[model samples]
Target: MSFTGTLDKCKACDKTVYFVDLLSVDGITYHKACFRCSHCKGTLAMSSYSSMDGVLYCKPHFEQLFKESGNFSKNFQTSKIFN
Candidate 1:
């Protein structure tokens, strides 16, 4: 019998992250399909995304949640936005 040693899991789904469909961001790995907006459950692209406190959000949701009246959040959470 053959064994595939230790598997890497997707943080969102808690499922195995196969090498072929891996999408890693900010040191975290996910399945290409698992890379989605946390708030709206919408699909996201590697080219554009917003990450806050390790959670991912689509552009609109991120703006709605973090942006307020032309003002930004008070550094409550470190964000890494790729757009």
Candidate 2:
């Protein structure tokens, strides 16, 4: 069965909420902006994880992309394909 949840936006900011999945366990959800990097305080971003592939991350963190890209349009085409 497929799991589903709301893509809640943060009240403080417009970033989407992200869910983290742990191995063979119920996942945890957190506001994408609510937590910051331990070292740089950069807003946390979710990366796809795999036992072999591991978690992926940009060097400067995800928030930097939000700023630099200056574009926040959701990909309706991509999202619709999933639905």
Candidate 3:
């Protein structure tokens, strides 16, 4: 009994994601349609997003939150791993 295929649960919809439709970030996997900004509910498929405390946010919202928390810095650098 050997399992050959990979399946992951979508964090938002709590559904199983097949390998072909899976989108992962930082180790968590989600279905393509389940990936969106946690704040504004904007689509992140082709945009920059940031994850904090297991929540996803679009770049602008992430920056705003960081600024409000007094954590914004001029020397801040975001690693570009996803395109």
Q: List the residue pairs that clash in candidate 2.
A: none
Off by over 4 Å in 2: 1-26, 48-83
lDDT of 2 by residue, 29-60 (tens): 34544444432445544442211122223445
lDDT of each: 0.78, 0.37, 0.75
RMSD of model 2 against the true structure: 15.6
- Backbone clashes for every candidate come to 0, 0, 0
lDDT of each residue in 1-83, candidate 1, tens digit only = 97573388889888888788888899898999989997678999976688877878888877876654344442334466689
How does candidate 1 fare on TM-score?
A: 0.71
Q: Of the candidates shown, which would achieve the greatest TM-score relative to the real structure?
A: 1
The order of the candidates by lDDT, greatest first, is 1, 3, 2
Query: What's model 2's lDDT at 17?
Result: 54
| Per-prediction TM-score | 0.71, 0.24, 0.69
Inter-residue clash pairs, candidate 3: none
